[model samples]
Target: MARPLLRLLAASCALGAMAGSAAAQVADHGAPWLENPFPSTYVPLPRSDVMLRHATILDGAGNRIDDGDVLVRSGKIAAVGRALANPGGAREIDARGRWITPGVIDVHSHDGTYVLPLTTIDREAGDVSEGSDVNVADTWIETAVNPQDTAFSRALRNGVTTIQILPGSSPIFSGRAVTVKPIRATSVAAMKFPGAPYGFKMACGENPKENGAETHRGPTSRQGVVTYVRKAFMDAQQILRDQKGEDGKPGPRRGPPAGRGPDLKREALAGIMAGDLRLNMHCYRADDMATMLSVAKEFGFHITAFHHATEAYKMPAALREAGTCAAVWGDWWGYKMEALDAVRANAPMLDRAGVCVTMHSDSPGSGQRLTIEAAKAAGAGRRMGIVVPPERMIRWVTSNSAKVLGLEDRIGTLAPGYNADLVVWSGDPFSVYTKADLVFIDGAIAADRSAPPASPASDFELGRVAAVRP
Candidate 1:
């Protein structure tokens, strides 16, 4: 009755013996997001052409342009330069002392899905784990998101224009994650970032073991976790083998070949192998990440990003070469054993090594002030003699984050043909006293401090959420 053996026995019992036909279908039409049965219904709010002149623009491309003007027309950036031509009918704003940058993007967030049950404010079912069994990779976090959660509004006020809502990290494969626009809506579909690739959520250490081994459900150890993950992918591979050559038909099942319908769980794994889904693994330790990287290579898959990579500084050379972005925090660490190795200079250290670094707010409270979080990492870099200016630091929450989800070209930059999602700061964004004077998404005034809370204000925060600019 060893823990590992017991875990395998349970998995076999749960996913045991589906007919060959079901496995075939799973591998054939894999990656639901490509065909997207539930497509996004998001349309940018109505906006007029706008011209913001005399602003310091942190272009989100590691360049700073002072006293520049940005023009927005038709929900897209028309041009960016010093004294760009203002459209004839655009509303002009005198941003003489303000700083403008591409909107902040939080790559790792659980706001709408894991809504906090605040006594003052306001939080999924069954999405993180299925039947208390790990490896529920097929489930969708979007279906479980509560649009009414007040965190979205708070995140908006904090200048977060976009955030990816992730499932809890309790399972080794904690289902799928969806990127969302921080706008008020009745359904998660309305908030979905249109055409963004879905993210496959996987965890390596700590959370999964505590959930499975402690609960006697599955995977009691790190080795056991890897074993479980490998077997799942192998099962998907078997499906692929059977379905090959005879496209659209059922492949021969190993034992007796008799099952109906596609196995969503296996399809998700196949999506990863096929490179249709981006893998965002929640791994804190470097050794575990290395192991996961090996597993991915073995199965011919790629990791898009590593969440909470506190120990990534140790393996920067490999991570940089692999092109894996390390989504980290500012200074929140050392409260646990795995996090004891965390250093304030982790982000800069990794950046200096040519690795992609992004600052993430894993908590609802932290999601609001993400710029401040990135500033903390930048300050730590300065202390280490690694020169990081506001322009470069802005990428930790903007362009680099967009790159994590493969949405860099559209959002995350204030360039022509990109989404006109930019924020105007009352002062230097790195300072604690600065506030987002205006937040624009797709050229529309999403949050404007010039007036009282307007369109972006949710029903939940109509009276309480106010503009905070001088």
Candidate 2:
């Protein structure tokens, strides 16, 4: 391992020399250079003041208030309490016998990138993987996200308001992920969450190695994956180093050495080092996670979260020590060798050990019912003497998931001055029979059970994809 890293360091230094001039042109790490060329044009729907009264409220931060009242004014949560002053001109809904909680957030999803109507014939059927290289950090998943994916509406009806659309894990550094609001829009920028930091997608264990072996490229072994990742970051570090001159001062501004363009690859990687892009990794085993943590330490970056961490329960203390969250499934296990040791009590065990844990849905179907998924994990714990209350269980799908996306302060809690992105359930959120009575995004009704167009549909579902003969 040491010999390979030394050789890689030498090779990356040469590549860095060619890219240094162009890379140094970037003033602020990677944020300014990789600024969304296509910025978000998200415009919240026009909304009126709303006051929900007489409901069981789970504030998404481990607080439960019975018979509470919540006030939404001008797209923000104005107040939340057992009783609130009723302002004039606000629509009051007596939410008797209902429950309220922050809208469900799915930290890991492939809805738009890997569209439905699965077929290889269409060019847009699958845009999840960029197979050209093992480290295509220059690529952005938002570029391939199709706005007409019908899965968005299904998730919305189930109270999923925000999602991070990540790239496939076929490569060590797959690409950058885009977080977006689940809204009907003609373009991805329209649904993009304003001011949300980008996510860098990474993977270890079977997927990358298998893809490399099959494609005859990238890393074909576990150690190879770590080595390739280290090499890429090392090159990024070299580029960042060039920002300072021989006099130990900031380098003079000379935009991109003639004939060279911006190095988007290194810029994205450097973004992670600069705290601009959150790092989300796909690792199943405890050993692989530990190895990745060492790489993060060497590069001086914090991993935001680990997705599909099937064996994360084996090392709760390490995750807590590293401040990395584990985004896992409820009962998924034994399907693959890496996930063979997955136990139902993964989340509860980690929570008991003071590790931040969330229940994530990697599938389109599972994305719609994340609350039930969290309940599944909690129920498993209950069967084994680990008690999880409703107030705390709600965080796994709401605040905890929001923390993984770095949007906890804004979207995940029903607090004053926060975005009024929440759901009103007909009954207890944990019950399978109960449905989201109302779903609000930015204090506007995005989905309503008793209203017209109860479930939103995309243009594709209403036009070309609908029955033509009828």
TM-score of each: 0.87, 0.90
Please, what are the lDDT tens digits per residue for candidate 2 over residues 172-237?
Answer: 888899999998888999999997867889999999999999999878999998889899888876
lDDT winner among the candidates? 2
Model 1, 108-220: lDDT tens per residue? Answer: 98877665554333213223234356888878888888897788877887688999988878888888889999988899899999878788799999888888867788898
Model 1: residues with Cα > 4 Å off, grouped in runs? 1-33, 118-131, 246-258, 454-470
Q: Which candidate tops TM-score?
A: 2
Give, for candidate 1, the lowest lDDT window spanning 10 residues: 1-10
Clashing pairs in 2: none
Cα-lDDT of candidate 2: 0.86
